[model samples]
Target: MSNNTSNACINDSTNQINIIFVGMYSFISIVGLILNLIALVVFCNNGRTRSHTVVYMTHLAFADLLLILTLPMRIYYHLGFTGLHQWMCNILGLVLKANMYSSIFFLMFICFDRCLAVNFPMSAPVQKWRKKAWLVCIGIWLLTFGASVPIYLSKPSNQTQDKCFDSIPVFAIQPIVVLPTLFVGFGLPLVLMLICSWFLVRAVRRSTVAQTNLVDSSKISKMITTSLLVFLVSFLPYHATLLLLSLNRHNITCPMLDAHRYSLMVACVNTVLDPVAYYFTTDTFKKKVDMGAFRRMLPLNSQSSDLTRRGRVAEDS
Candidate 1:
């Protein structure tokens, strides 16, 4: 009777937490979807999308957008709408995991790209490769997709009413997969980002031009700082929770499980915050968005003349 009562209590607690998670995911889904969609339109329409930095950011926004697109099903599943087929659940879960990792890697790519640009401005090959950023982006997508396939295939079988994000039975291949994933997917990228940010900061401090242009220096610093903070704030907690869950799989604690769910929800906030990075770091995007807003507020003929006058004044200053 005591054992049964304990189990019942645990179930009730889990259900309550699941309800909270549903609310969190619903809020993140709505806000992240809207923000990423706007970011996609802005990045796609802007002429600056041709640049390597913008190219990486464009792909990053697309990845986040795709991830959030899967959130409605997740929210519904959490809210006890569990009539979904197991295959559909697996596919949706796989997409969420796949894009989450892809977003991390793409952000890493952006950091590395910026580091290269700042640290080696005159290298001919580095400059030439900027034009081939599309190739790099394609390669990253292919690599991320291939890495995700094993996890997708390893999806645990589930009952009809099972929560979509519930822990699955460990598969024989899961150890082989999870170990590398924990290290490679989370650890390595984090280390690389830190290294890149460190180098960027050091390079900026050393650059004479950075000293002359306080505004540019501030912008660059803000970009790197925000990127690092997002990675730390969003990805680190989730991955730390994942690591703990993986280690404690045999004797799972309810609090640890709740932590994992909450951390994952926190990571979703990255999608909403990424547009802020674009606004701070990308000059062309900032200029274009500003011009767009200005055009909307002014008459068509006055727009061109005003923009011309402002450009001349800026040059004079």
Candidate 2:
């Protein structure tokens, strides 16, 4: 009787947690959809696609938009609406995971582009590759889809009683798939982002006056800092929890499970935060945003070159 009661209590607790999660997902889905849609429209207007950074950001917003679109089914599933066929689940799951990784890689690509602009400003390949950014975005989408195949194949055909968006048991799938995903999907990209950020900082410090003027140094600094923060605060915890859950073979304690749930939600919150990053980082996007309001909220150092020259002349006189 005691054992049965304990099990009942645990189930009730899990259900309540799922309810809260569903509510949060609904909110994020609505807000993320709107923000990303606006971002796409802004990026598409006025020939903004010509810039490499805008091209990457436009794709990133599209990926996030798709990810948000999957949330309604998830919300419904969590609210006890069942009877979904296995294939439907698999397709939804595949798209969700694929786009999640797609957003990660595209953000990494943006970082790499910025790093190149800062460190190799005069390089021919850097100048030449801007036109080919669309091709690179296409390759990223293909690679993301390819990586999702293992997930689709391994997912169970019947999960009527299973929790929505739950992780598959680690032993059920080939280690090859799981291990590579942990490394490539999260670890490798994270390392590359850190390296790019380090190089970008160094380049900014060594930049000449002309280079600094060409790209707003303050904006670059803000972009790199925000990107690193997003990776560290949002993505890192979620991946760590996933790694631990997988390593423990689905026998993790309740606290760890809760941590995993919360961390995953935090990671999803990145979809909304990304627009803020783009506004600060992308010159074209920044231009579209109301400068008066933006400056009032986050004022830039406004001492102009002419003002500095006048001050110097005053001192000399």
Candidate 3:
């Protein structure tokens, strides 16, 4: 095929992929949002306030919820929103980018927290360090908000085929956006999680030797492993694409366009896969869903005192 013909074909193929992903992304975003919202509600109502796992889950839900909130703008972009109330378009793009990237930080923190808990059970302040956790959560949001501020303020407005709006300042774009996110979000998290999982496995292995040895907590380990896997798989491609696309300057070539579209779809998939992982990993969430319970059956102050005591006992032992 001639270069012109090949380019046209590539353009058409890219559009087709975008169309398919746009609709799928919207649907998945809606489902993820609902599931995360439900998990949030259950966490709040069930008086799981004392559980560190619950706290992490709550924050994760918050991150996923934000991602869902931004989906409409994405749908608009792909569906072609022109003259979309200037402010609306800007806000939409801003929110979409912010939430999209912020989710990575949340995932990173969760991995770090889990790793700490698993590897240093005694030192890892699970729930007693709730204040610290809150601070960390606040820090994560603030840092991400600052990092993604460009997406909101700098996104090119009046974007059309002929017109252009640079989503972020070219100079402001740095490895901070890609390298740190990749390292912290996927690289560091994956390594730490693997180490944590290894230690957890060893812990479980030792448990088998003692008569009173607790059966392996396969549930939590499985959940963490699954979460790490999904997070790494779904996000690596998107970030990698961004890194490569960053090299794309004034180029509308087939390969660049193909990667750009594919990355977008992968990011969308994360929105869907995230909630599924959350639901599977959290037993409290699962129980709530299975029991069709929205409200707390016990008192608001109720907690698994025995479990808390046992956790403390186990650590002491």
| Residue range 60-131, candidate 1, lDDT tens digits | 988888888888887776665545677786777777778888888888888888777776666799878766
After superposing all C-alphas onto the true structure, candidate 1 shows an RMSD in angstroms of 5.1
- List clashing residue pairs in candidate 3: 156-165
In terms of lDDT, the poorest run of 10 residues in model 3 is 162-171
Residue 70 Cα positional deviation in candidate 3, in Å, after optimal superposition? 1.7
Candidate 3: tens digits of C-alpha lDDT, residues 40-117: 777776563335555556776787787677666556555543334555645654555566666666665565565455
lDDT of 1 at 27: 74
Model 2: worst 10 consecutive residues (lDDT sum):
308-317
lDDT of each: 0.68, 0.67, 0.57
Residue runs of model 3 more than 4 Å from their true location after superposition: 1-18, 85-87, 124-131, 151-177, 184-186, 206-215, 250-252, 295-317
What is candidate 2's lDDT per residue for 1-317, written digit by digit as tens?
Answer: 12333334345543443667788888889888887877776666525124676778889999988888878877876776655565766777778778888989898888887677666657788768855889999999999998787767866555434344553333323456657877888888889999998887776677573254455556567777898887777688877777776666435565556677677777778788888765444544555454332332344633212112221100110
